[model samples]
Target: MAGPGAYAAVWEPGRQNVTRYRLTPRGWPEGRRLRLAILSDLHVGSLHVPLSRVSELVAATNALAPDLTLLLGDFVASRARIASDPSLADLATELARLQARDGVFAVLGNHDWWHDEPTQQLRQGPTQVGLALERVGIPVLENKAVRLDTAGGPLWLAGLGDQIAFLSRGRRPRGIDDLAGTMAQITDDEAPVIMMAHEPDVFARMPDRVTLTLSGHTHGGQVRFLGWAPIVPSRYGNRYAYGHVREAGRDLVVSGGIGTSQLPIRFGIPPEIVLIELG
Candidate 1:
């Protein structure tokens, strides 16, 4: 669902350049404002996208000084060019530079599967890059959960594997049932629940226990005409563009993501790195 190469191309009215969203949701507890940055779909390795773009994105995000950082997926392109290129080494290095208060959490994306040829590998594709990320201190979560203790309290964060994994194997991806159980394990009564998922399609069956869900994969349909994005690919259709939606009494923020994929050009849609404030 990332744009042509690896970014979103939507315009934010009044902002000279494209801008990411800063969402503030209710029931977030008083004096517990949490600022989170969400970036996704870098699709590194394609000629369409360059490593410098992502380095710039990290610089901009660190400048914001967010409480936590969440990476929603598609860190690399599985296309032939990138799949076989050694340039991915630099791409991984650039991503490891991102800084956040609590820490950075990531999930995998469809393009990752597409480029990696996971079928041939018959192994957990993210492990290679995931380990690389860990070498630099970033943690990749696949159908797992981690609790972060912040000034507000302990935040129970859960991540689901790339839903596209099912498309290749014809079976449900691993972490569909991870959320509720993770929430049950967290003892914090103040810190709210958070989840990072790549595709917004899971919105249809999202659990209500989590206070907010952060995702990216639609790329705002890459092109919007007459205020409507006509080619939405995620399971939610137009419902999965760049914005907030209430599902089962919980809120979801789907970022426009920060790179391009198959094609480098962006028309109405512009790449964005979102900032979400929960209080």
Candidate 2:
């Protein structure tokens, strides 16, 4: 007989849900309404996320017809390399089907950098998944920001490098994320900023200039008991583990994220494709 642990690890993680949240950030344009689709930590080729699941992900996203779609990285499964999974080319091919009015953008996560030895070793340039994303017409934002003209007004989208990229560099796990450099890329001083970071720990120092920040990597702790994540990978513990958070008048939404990491089990928190409406 299969116990609940087995179901949490095997059966439940594969089920996907479309979770929705609404937020009106401090600087969000009054007349502008934006719908965003956030896909995070797919962990393709993981125990539950197979190559075939990409199509399903893309299809579900398109049906929503969001104003913008963001991929929050971790394309490869943990404890494995991109070469071991379905080829990046194959994964990108399906991701290409995603459509958003403002277009789709992406950023690399810890797993993406850790698994791609070439990129991690170099400690610079695009990761294997980043290149694949670009080839399929998705913009990979690496410590970079872009200005988008929206009906509400102009908005700045900034993407940061993974906070923990290399496993070891001089006895410390070095990250490529550049918060200051990324913030400096923004030329629009008035437009509201939305940051995409793979890790949520940055929320503590998140400047008031940014209206909203989106993150993943914790996977809502992959398991929660009565809304408490017993094992959060973040330095802040459960402070930024999951769900929408508002601190000091700024907003941060951490999706439960798809797939599992470190351990392939999910209870109380299932995989989800986040649809956020901002006005």
Candidate 3:
């Protein structure tokens, strides 16, 4: 087993690796290309992902000059003490600096919904986090879709709420994610649809209309050795744990995400920001 210092050395909080991918989808216009930057799983309260790192992440993402920026969730580490973390607000402030031609869009994650343990009397973390991002002009899409007119053409963007909240929390505190309703908003225009879902497992249920899906909850197994991850938090096992996956002609990009969860150790997989080019 590695010692604590070794783990700390490997978990450089402000370090970010950029992973790029190029995709050709049938829905994309012939001569037009769109660049999208995905940033996920900041986990601000975690020792391996301090709130101070938000500025670095924002700078790196802005430098890419993507047409659209997607903020996949896990802003907080999910510890009970996170409620008291003063840096959460500051993290939102830094995130507000993120720039894109269309706009900055976001979706919640399991950690963002984990406001309290079952034993706690009150749960308010999810609401607070959403409000923070909205205050900074980041629209948090919860089972809703938006249409953006880009130079290429009309683009459809839809997002689902964190699956954990709908499946476990009963959705009373927050509304349930309606994938069907979200897709219904897409007209017959046949524009490219990009769905933002925190968990990649949702990709399996996506219809053919969705051209691409983006997610970042696995943390790329957080620890991997010999090309095998000992732990992956997904019902689909390692199938959607990381990287680009295509199913039924729909593409899914699962980011490894920045920050540690449960443990502050990363072996072979480093935190990353995913840049996707679609044409």
Candidate 4:
């Protein structure tokens, strides 16, 4: 029943934008700057999100020349039935082209965990996706943290498992995110902590120790009218749906993301790759 305009909007996956922001967290050192490029919700194998777009995305991110790169999750879209699609290895190979001084890191998303839902009934997708990314030299952090020695200073990067995965049937599912366990890896003298979580709902539960959290699960409601999205899949509704928010004495950057879910069309809310600069 949709018209030509609707189909055009849904099929134009190449329509992406670069969003930039500057943040100076509480614990950040004085007179130092760090640039981080974030790409999220790249629902590859989904309608309109083809493998070719992956190459273009990589090139665009590299052009930004960020000090660090973060992938927020949902590399593939979930479907009721399992079928042959682009191999994760191939996808990883293309994503490996990303350039960052510190490194490129990632976390799993709900779709990655539920890729086989209602059909194959297996939870191996997340593990396989992680392995593929790791094989390509990208570390997939699952409730884990790492310290990167950037030009600005030492930075603590932490990643948590998908909050939705905690409620879904998946490999080693948990009821809630383990932020404490991930932060335990950092010491007192460590630099500011930046956490990557799939859903922004975890922002409300985070402690002050976390300086920033990056997420991309809502897709900015996937559709919008007059700057308000009609439908958003979050426990907090549109509260953490998109853009930057300061909460719990910390900062959260929720990317609109580069792919669609449930439906492929987007109106008003275009896909984006976030460029965050911290000083």
Among these predictions, the greatest lDDT belongs to 2
Per-model lDDT: 0.68, 0.89, 0.81, 0.83
- Candidate 3 residues lying further than 4 Å off, grouped into runs, are 1-14, 116-126, 166-175
> Tens digits of per-residue lDDT for model 2 on 61-165?
999989899999888888766456798999998999999988899998998888877876677756888899899899999899999985456799999888888
My TM-score estimates for the predictions, one after another, are 0.82, 0.95, 0.89, 0.90
- For 1-279, candidate 4 gives per-residue lDDT tens digits of 577466446544558899999999878889999999999999998776788989999999999999999999999965632465688899999999999988899998887766544312443334667889999999998889888889778888899977766334455444335777887888876578889999898898887888898999999888877767889988788888899998756899999999888877777778899999998
Clashes of 2: 0
In order of listing, the candidates' clash counts read: 19, 0, 0, 0
Per-residue alpha-carbon lDDT of model 3 for 1-279, expressed as tens digits? Answer: 567457545644346799999998656678889999999988887776666677778888999999999998888885655455655567788889999998899998876766535412343334667888888888999888999997557889999877776223544334356789899888766678989998888898988888889999998888776766889998788888888988767789999999888877777778899999888
TM-score of 2: 0.95
- The Cα error of candidate 4 at residue 140, in Å, is 0.6
Model 2: weakest 10-residue lDDT segment is: 76-85
User: What range of 10 consecutive residues in model 1 has the weakest lDDT sum?
Assistant: 8-17
Runs off by more than 4 Å, candidate 2: 82-84, 169-171
Query: Which candidate number would show the highest TM-score if scored against the true structure?
Result: 2
Q: Which stretches of candidate 4 lie over 4 Å from their true place?
A: 1-8, 11-13, 80-84, 116-126, 166-176
